[model samples]
Target: MPLEFVHSPTQQTFDIGSRLTRLLTLLFSLVIVFNTIFAFSVLVNLKSLDTCMFLSSDCSWSAHIDYIKDKAWSRVNILRSLKFTLDRLTLETINMTFIRPLLEYGDIIFDNCTAGEKQELDKIQHEAARIVTGATKLVSIDKLYSDLNWQPLSDRRTNHKLIFMFKIKSNISPTYLVNLIPLRPADPRYNLRNSSDIPLIHCRSTLYYNSLVPSAIRAWNTLDSSFKSADSIQSFKRLISNTPKVPHYFNTGPRRLQVHHTRLRLDCSLLNYDLYRKNIISLQACLCGDSESVRHFMLFCPLYTSYREDMFESINLLVPGTAITLDLLLKGNVRFTDPFNSQLFSIVYSYIDSTKRFI
Candidate 1:
């Protein structure tokens, strides 16, 4: 690709600038110099890269969103090729490597794109989740993300945006970007409650609502005082882990059987009910004669009563306050901390595996 000159954009100015695209002169000399000197250089092509894809007469990237969408789905389609070959964990890692960077390429700017735009990107994430977990198209997109313990692209963008905002506040980002972040003025007379936080940029235009400055500031101000007090960006990044986009499962034990648990959670297992629905069997009834279902299989299956009894006993001993329920055993609970939840999942899956229900 050859150098293409671009003027610094004037409108929709509150943006994630130079993160990918920068105004480079069309003069071939500078291009050659940059190419030779820099270890990494992206050819300045608006159509080739998303950073400059936002360029339009109206300053709306909505025009190029389709390009980004198609590009992402292409990458996802490539991941789909490995759907059957790789395990969930490996597939997820590959997805993060190939697809996530594409989706998040310029999310600080994409963060403020229209809902339709965000939804398009989200579809890619959901599709990746489906591929990674081996879930069918019938699985709920949210459910796929939940089972995989992955954040939606929107939440992930918010996270990256907050981190970027933090960098701007710390004066590590570009001067133009840093200058855009306004700190709340300190005044003694009637110091209001939220005075410690940054101020929001009031804008009348719906387009401005998604501007990087206001959106980042809004999310930044919502942070806890402790988060704001962090001296280094690393600590702040670590703290972000406490807030998951989707509630995470402890997900312990061998990785292989986790999918079995997911099948149970999604109720897409080889249970007689699912089998009957697929017309694989004449009856949905269990050998014990009740309608074969998740509740029946996990809770009341007389066949697995012996293993189920031990699983419940371990859960009760581990977390007494937790009420015994299908969800608790299947999905675990948010109230249970990470370590406890791991133990809970271990017990539940242990019982399920012993039953050889999905084996």
Candidate 2:
């Protein structure tokens, strides 16, 4: 029985392997055709649009700046037209509440702006400040910013980026951006140098890399220790929002008075002398035929002698026998040592107000 069972050495079998391969090829061809049709449809729809609706995943400062300018200028123009009807404070409020928000709607877009672009955007803010405060053409931009409690657009953008990073770091929200930023190492050796140390990223495109992660990390590392040590993301935001904008030296007194003092110090007053200087109106000279300058009004003008004497006495009380020099008055270089520089500002404000009627 065993010898009777025999099998052929060369036996033909079903070609299942070739059949399966043909099936896979047909499926792949259909998939490719479907994808091609879908892509064509997308391109056709995109071409039909008047303007491109999608933002590039990569940051484009030029596009963002143009868009922001368009949004901001519309509001700014309205404010400018109403300059006669609106006071400085009201104008500033409108800018802060309405115009500024428009400018800052997608502030993360500014994180990658070149220095030149940043300066250009900052100029827009400077222009807004000038318009809001009615500052003359001659007023210093820095002084205007100080007066308005506004940070440069560059600084604001950095703040916004870091705040976003903080939110990601604190797990306040789950975002793909968190994966781009590496967590600090637990090793003491790694963290010994800077409390806010961040690991370096190696990539061919530094700008793109910075746009995604390094910029935020760099900004966060430079933050004050208090900011770094915040207990929660919300607390961190609250602290940042309430933080003093200007340096302690310039942040003296009530905000309103600070604004007034800034105007006076920057020669933005509506005195006839300043008006004539700005060519807003014609005036030959002071009544005494002296060249009408801030120095002349604050110090040498005969009309303000009484007020000058009172101001000097008040100033001397702070720093005994401190003389108010032209340099001191206009440049804020006081000889006296008030930590906040409040006394010098107060004396200057008083002197300017006192001379207003005389002018």
Candidate 3:
């Protein structure tokens, strides 16, 4: 029989109410089980700490130790919720890392609501799950889930009542079962926070107007080998004062050119397709495609090993013992000095820019 044809308004409402109640009961049971599991995990992990001992009021312990304890407690709550729901509801044992613990908290509170209240809570949770599931991250969820060996739960194998329960307990969307997954954060229409605020109003005119120069000056001051003497200070100020005037780049202010940092060189070469490619791709080593990240390209990719070989030789000339990891470069430990560093940075930036140009 057709679903609509079989439905009586009174019977339909009763069925809906019954389905909702069962879902709530299942979800509530899950939360209790999850909480117990989480508490046990924490108790086991923190066995080293005496439960009877006073937590120190000392500032150092208060700052670091207390902060860790609070984070652990929050994790305990979420894990406990997951364990509780899974045990009572007969859910397939899937890895729980993809689940958001905070949303799990919301789900626990949601299960206790009245039928009408449950509907409202469901709406809120669905929306929140939509936001979080569609959030901006270093990697794509589809790719990440595939890598993590997550199998989509089918409605045929799974209980329809429990499907509703999954939605309630996991705070997850039922959309995945239908093969409709979200676009990643990189996509323009991806339903996540995708835009940053463009500064329209300047809070401080002088600071805003000379934003580039001031940042450079501040960066120079912050360097490990910062300019100290009066002569050095004068030279730094001269660099700031002599920057070329940008045409309304930042309210049409003049830019001062200080000592030639490779960062400034790269900024100036943003339009240079080759240099931009290398720099941007290098910077994004941690976040690029499955096998095409900066790390993979620099240290591992046979396709780009020639570039790595050249860069390594250059580094060996300047600072002989630098690792090729992107982290080491970002930390300024990888011998980024003078013409050698500048040439290397430009090459990498140019490579990145060239790839982007073709794309």
For model 3, how does the per-residue alpha-carbon lDDT over 1-359 read when each residue is reduced to its tens digit?
A: 65566678999999999999999999999999998897677446434322221234431123332333354354444444444233211111111332223223323212322345334323332322222222112233343233223322221112222233223223354555322222224534544332321112233654343333222233333333322222343453443333332211111111111111112222222223223355543432222333343345435656555556676676667566655556443223333444444444444454443334223
Model 1, 13-108: lDDT tens per residue?
A: 534444324443345668788766542321121123343355678776776677777776876776777566555666777677656777788778
Clashing pairs in 1: none
Query: TM-score rank, highest first?
Result: 1, 2, 3
- Please give the distance, in angstroms, between residue 47's alpha carbon in candidate 2 and its true position after superposition: 29
TM-score for candidate 2: 0.60
lDDT of 1 at 110: 58
TM-score of each: 0.64, 0.60, 0.20
Candidate 2 — worst ten consecutive residues by lDDT sum?
45-54
**Cα lDDT, all candidates:** 0.74, 0.66, 0.35
The C-alpha local distance difference test score for the whole of candidate 3 amounts to 0.35
RMSD of 1: 19.7
Which candidate number maximizes lDDT? 1
